[model samples]
Target: MAVDKVFDAIVVGAGHNGLAAAVELASRGWKVCVLEAKSTAGGAVNTQELTLPGFRHDVCAMNLSSFAGSPFYARHKDALARHGLAFVPAEHCFASVFRDQSWLGVSADLDTTVQRIRAVSEKDAHAWQAMLADFQIKAPHLFAVLGAPMPSWKLARSAWRSWRELGKEGVAELLQLLLATPRDFLDRHFESESLKAMMAAWGLHVDFAPDTAGGALFPYLESMANQAFGMVIGQGGADTIITAMTGLLQELGGQLQLDAPVCRIEQDKGHAKAVVLADGRRLQARKAIIANLNPQLVFGRLLDAQSVPAKYQKKVDEFRPGLGTMMLHLALDSLPDWTAGAELQRFAYVHLAPDLAMMSRVYAEAASGLLPAEPVLVVGQPTALDPGRAPQGSHVLWVQVRVLPARVCGDALGRIAAGDWSQIKQDYAQRVLDVLEAYAPGLRGKILASLVMSPQDLEQFNPSLIGGDNLSGSHHLDQNFFFRPVASYSRYNTPVKGLYLCGASTWPGAGTGAGSGFMLATMLAA
Candidate 1:
């Protein structure tokens, strides 16, 4: 604690990844300090009473499918659980509602889902089962390839195993799955638009569109994984993970300073040496400096321009944020009386879209910096899974309006003014609600209160969500895996001595999963 002595390490940002890094380092008896710009931690993964008093809504992240399967959670489950983290599971995980009001979704049991597919097409039912079977065979390797640090033995061995398990022909098919568009992938497997639409809805969760290459994996994993393990939400809110992480960090002797934003990373001969705080305080790290930030922030804003290499600076400058999103939180007196039968009330999420074309149209329109005529909506009724989120007999809904422009330039309807999200966000939220009303009649009447967060609002709340991009940066083919940030430092190490990077901007980009964090922690700890 003395000014004369340096700490073992210092972490900037108290997001899940930063917290994970602190936990790993502190557990090894290293003295650690974590600085957070916000008053509290959990950056984008937070919960708040945004709509009304007593109605707790997840600020951004809600689903925990990736977190449930993440290696970080696996190793820290006991500690997290002991610190008051509880997850509620949903058997009927997700569904897609069409214009005709018909819906298709997955169930906890594969046989149950196969039966539902049979109702649409018996051939599609068989194909659905085949995909699940192949996933079971190739899952271990596929997950390894995703979770491990790129260009490492772990990734190399995982791919090799996949090639071995799937014969040459099967491996070729798997490669095609990786490269194909979501529409192409679906068309190759199923005949029913309803079935394809249900799975393709998963692509919108990320920035991927129907025709976007490297998008097939999201829909494939979403459908097959839901059938395998279903979806999970925290008991009370998404911050249950945050609460538990903070407790774990504190217990491991890591100190956290809130509202202490780092002004710059002080470099000594091109080596990361210390951090200068906005308040003019200096914290020196004896061992390493880890930043859980997007590449733009870490290299573009936080470091001296002259200190970074030209190529690295260019790569960071070119880092593209994904399409923006709008979040709608509603406090209702009762659950949505879904027309798809009350069975939908038992599911976790219901997506509002007619088919893959609708999803594509929205993406195209948004990519053009215009609001769409009809945006794909992800309607989450977590109260169906965790009743503790609202007062007794009442419910809360989390709606994500996908494929909005980061910088609005036009409106599909030509009603709203151009490039002014702040000017028309409320009207936009209403349009989204109107879409919801089409699928769930009388949904407008059930609302006691509502909260709308525009893309600008999201970025304002967390500057790291630059331009309202929740995924940190785009996961397109050119910027993913080994090519992420840049191919040179994809292993988490930086050109600066004793500097590392982790978070959604790093490997295993996006999601609440702490892959990059845990991976970097493991490497540094070793």
Candidate 2:
């Protein structure tokens, strides 16, 4: 499609958030155009044949539970379904395998989960049931805070309601849980070390280590929610939501330009007026412009020095990114025959972090720029839930090596020399496979092909994943909520008028939640 000289909004980046904001504006009868540097849409939320022709792999994100339950999806569910969006439900949401060759899995069926917990520890099984019972009362209050815009009147209202319903004691307890570390939270709730290990792995999904404060909330929610509502992956790949959103946008008369990167934001008297493309094409925005990139990229690179204050720019510079990740995609002739049991083959995710102590050690090593001796592996069995991702009778594995340094200094094992990513990625990949092969004995032998995406490769694939921080920015208490990107601009508005920020870098960070995008769109359009 030809570029319009002007539009009501010109969104930079064709990421899910950018597309979402565009779709919302277009639906409100505004002319919008989304510009993406890459030929494809979906930044971290993409799927491709990275390994072999018959094997389809979700490049970064695989779980769609967040997107499925998002307010954006809720509002446009029928429209999305009409655009070919579908999900495959998993009765077995996730599990954790131990060095002892035993495993603990969570099933959608509460009774089944209780049984498994009982097999581990009868006391913990009672504790598991107790947590589930409390979840019914607590989840609504927790979701109220997470689903609202940070530091907004809506958030205040949510707090008021929680106070009214729960009274002083309950609200205080909620605050304590929110501030607790993953290990602290687990220690307070359960007795079994393996059970605690199983839950703490949820922390690493969002850059939380076992000892990181403000990490407990994620593990609590994931455990409770999976037990309550089950889990869902996109029918074919994680990009299903992206495809649906783009379809909906075009259906509403919005324009999306691929291979069009914005080089500069044109400003007039401290007001964003237009954007200059990399190809030297100038296009004007009549009303607003939304940037779905990290704040550093936006404030430091895209905008002129005079456009933003020095203090604000410094804050953007100080906005920290979490530890890096390496993605491994495998095309296997058959799924891993787990030595623990074949029952482990049925679940969606099998985490390989053995205990809380090891989880803490890995995070410390990664933070110090050392490759962990034993990195935490999130082994995803998407093909188990959706066989269409691979050829008939074959399977695909999505392995995420979490909590690694973006820059390598040395190896903790002291075997592989410290070098650039290209020099050591294969050796590192083999180490990851060796860790997995211990649990699934013949894992490496069944591989038809494999693709290793180092942190550098991830950044190369999508610039928004700076340093391969898939969450875009850290989710620590100081960097989260109202402090995201920066404390002053937490509501998505910039110092420059008519310009805004959104995406994983904003409040309610990461995953396929679509919270930040939907929240920003509703605010702007209103």
Candidate 3:
């Protein structure tokens, strides 16, 4: 019951961010120890055979475009790559199919993509070219702001540089892009509904809907970035980054303690000193304490009441989690035969949202505690990109139905009864399959086996996915940027001395970038 094990730093939750922190600290000879609640390292990025044997499914996260573009990966690329982490890029990043059997998507080749857009509107094709050109000019400054820590001169300097580069009119356009809705931005540039709908779906991946303010930037970034640099995913599963990061951490002499859920943060003299494990063991930290958790979990549950101020507690209480998501992992006999034709098979993501209005209705209905009639479906056929996932002839489908209420009260279409997720998850999953079969006929028949994780199941799998929100917290205007997690702690430094936050809950929020952790490591090392 009594042990004395001291470390230079203690990192909580062995997610990408937590592992990153451990690796960086150990690289600096900090003698770090990482504590993860789960049995394995990867948090949402874990890979497993959810449906059947040999059918590897990414439980939560699948895309690695953000990770591949991250400065964290950039700094440790060779080391990570040498650890057997391979990335397979998509030829076609994404496609959105319509009820009329027409589809629109973006590919690695600009000419091929332009031709696709030209088929709908020639003017929009030129607009795509112009947008990429502008991105080339503004990307350095834009990404600098996104990646830089908030409440610092680093972000300010980047913004100033952008202002000088863009001048008056260009600055106004940039502001409009940042402030305007996805509908406004796309309608301003492109004339086709498919082009607009195709790109706007990415916003749903975050907190934004098509009409949500502060949504324009996500669509622009995902589309333009994919065109500039192809979308990359782990070769076999999304957990490849986790494997590589764990290897690096262990190689640097850091210890990863699995299945060790930290019950409380032990503080003394207004500084976080150690974490008490669930098994009544206390792991002491001599230097710093890093929490890879949602602010609510860290403050509301783990830390002492007096550890944070009243105002900060109120902010944490007000920390809104985005909409819940339901995951459908399927081991299919073959990939869904999209009615839009064979070309659609090359893409990583095929969105079933027909237009902006449908996406709007889904967000509205879900927020009102009702599952949408036509839920926006992100049908991911990962096996298309990597043929090594399943049996030689078999394939796997990673389907995510967006904008479901965390606690479902009723279905918008009035099909499923309002009840606990345990009772209705299967029915809800069937609803998702209904929509998928509509877009991609014969899809339902191809399923050899399937597994559905409800919103509650998601929360149970990882407490960070509060109310099944994969982004950790909402990415709305008031809660984003300098206001992320909260205004006072936006710089990753908490109110408590030597306590740092690093996770999806922090800035450069969400996805598998490992940005926040890497940034903290860089800051603390300096």
Scored by lDDT, the top model is 2
Angstrom error of the Cα, residue 114, model 2: value is 0.5
**Model 2, residue 195: what's the lDDT?**
95
lDDT of 1 by residue, 162-222 (tens): 7887788877877888788899999988999999999988888889999999999999988
Q: Worst 10-residue stretch by lDDT in candidate 1? A: 1-10
Rank by lDDT (best first) = 2, 3, 1
For candidate 3, give the lDDT of residue 286: 85
Instruction: Give the CA lDDT, 0 to 100, for residue 47 in model 2.
Output: 94
Worst 10 residues of 3 by lDDT: 1-10
Q: What C-alpha lDDT, on a 0 to 100 scale, does residue 139 get in candidate 1?
A: 76
TM-score (C-alpha) between model 2 and the true structure: 0.98
lDDT of 2 by residue, 167-270 (tens): 99989989999999998889988999999999999999999999899999999999999999999999999999989999999999999999998899988898
Candidate 3 residue lDDT tens string, 1-526:
3546899899999999998888887888889999999899899999999999999999999999999998988888999998988999999999899879999889999999999999999999999999999898888877887889987788788778878888878778878888889998998888888899899999999978888999999999999999999899899999999999999888989999999999998777878888899989988888889999998888868986666787888888999999999999999998888878988988999989898999999999999999789888898889999989999999999999898899888889888899888899998888888888887788888999999998899999999999999999999888888898998789998878878898999898998888899888878887
* Candidate 2 ranges beyond 4 A from true positions: 1-4
List TM-scores for all candidates, in order. Answer: 0.97, 0.98, 0.98
Q: How many backbone clashes does candidate 2 have?
A: 0
